[model samples]
Target: MAGSGDAAKEYIAGSAAGVAQVVVGHPFDTVKVKLQAHNTKAHRKLYKNASHCTSRILVEEGIRGLYKGASSSFVGIALESSLFFGTYAHAKQLLQGKYEDGKPQLQVIIPSAACSGALISCILTPTELIKCRMQVQGKDAMHATWYSSPLDCAVKTLQSEGVRGIFRGGLATLFREAIGNAFFFCSYEYSRYWMHSYTDSPRFAGNSNLILAKDVGIGIISGGISGMAFWTTTLPLDVAKTIIQTDPSPLSSRNPLRVLSMVYRRAGLAGCYAGLGPTLARAFPANAAAIVAWEYSAKVLGIRGS
Candidate 1:
């Protein structure tokens, strides 16, 4: 009973952090999505050089065009991050059942993190699909006419694809969420722990000002590490997801592994990482700002890191 109550509180904090992150960090995400979703040549032109792309977007689309799908991204990320944090904290608690003295044991932390990652993937699939489509922004795709506002996208996807459409390329997203998220929590907690001890007592379990700085710092560093992890481990899957999301055709019911191999054959290594620079750049501040929001959100929930 007591554990349940604590979980409720933690979820609140997590959700709050997510909301704050959307408010502060979404514009960068907007740019990243544009870069990722652009119809660049897979091995050659998919991602125009960052400077060239930025300049082109500004000159052609104006500032508004650069932020085309921002509304959808903001909404999607808010819900996604909130659910992610809420689940992550509780999952950690569940995995690390009481120690002999009755506290989170911390032994099963990684799996806990993984579970949270997986859960958030399911929750965010619908919004994520919409956001990804909007970010890429092509008129040729079948989904081009489906959205007006964020809600419109969600509704249209539901109506057309049933529950499944909402999860277009969800398998890839699932893998990305689970794997990338695993790295996120692990890096965040471990970093905080390291900062706390800097020597031995790893585990950021107390202190005020230090906790604030540590949480913010942890978020920044962990976000970057998580980005690297996703970039490396799931770049191929991301390529598939991006392709399917933007392509005019539906995700064939074929095995994802098979699909990935096809993409690899067609595009090769360079195709897989078309827009890595902007991705890493966005990951840094988006994550840093999100973490900053998480810390303040924790205080709002009456659980200041200290």
Candidate 2:
């Protein structure tokens, strides 16, 4: 009964934190997606850089443009975060049971996070496909008619391409989520563990009672590092995923690796990281706030991190 109650609390906390993360992060994400999907070789490039994209979005579409696909992102993130944190908690518990001291090492935590990430990727692919399609619209007349909103995008995709339409970038998403999250969770847990050791704080010494301020601070640091690690490790896959998801033509979206190869051939290595600036800019603060929000909310709900 107690374990079930704690799990419920953790789920709620994760959902709230996910909403908070999307609110803080979506604008930057919009810019990043646009830039990643932009065709630089065009006679008139849509955006020269991250700042240019931001300014153009402001001038052309107003503030609302910055949050074009926020509704979809909100829903997607809320579901993803709830599943991720809840799964991680349960996986940690299972690992603890396996260990003699009832405290799993980083090896256990890493695989747990990886598996959770893979599971979440199943849902995330379609969610992001809809969101990215909506976001790329409104940038120009060519794309403006592509989608009226996230819902319209999803509906159109269903009608045009069937159920498989929504999962355009599932392979890339799976790879990115699984591999990237492995690094992200490992970095976060290792950083927190190091902080506990370095500070020698009793609160961080055990899993039961962590100091709120210290934990939040460490979460911020860990989140930033993890964000960088994720992006660095999976930027190419992410770029491919974005391109595949945002492509308007049904036939063009068939092979992510083919698209990636074309991108590499056309633009070289740099092409694989088109929107890196905006992505990195968004990753740190956004993830920091998200991790802090998740940890803080969990604490408020009487769910301690193991």
Each model's backbone clash number: 4, 0
Worst 10 residues of 1 by lDDT: 97-106
Best by lDDT, which number? 2
Residue pairs clashing, model 1: 40-46, 41-45, 41-46, 193-203
- CA-RMSD of model 1: 4.1
Cα lDDT over the full model 2: 0.82
**For model 2, the run of ten residues with the poorest summed lDDT:** 39-48
What are the per-residue Cα lDDT tens digits for candidate 1 across 254-279?
34566667655756665566566666
Off by over 4 Å in 2: 40-44, 100-104, 201-211
The digit string of per-residue lDDT tens for model 2 on 106-195 reads 768888888889999998999999888877876464552467778888898899889988898999999899899888888887887787
Query: What lDDT score belongs to each candidate, Candidate 1 first?
Result: 0.62, 0.82
> Which candidate has the highest TM-score of all?
2
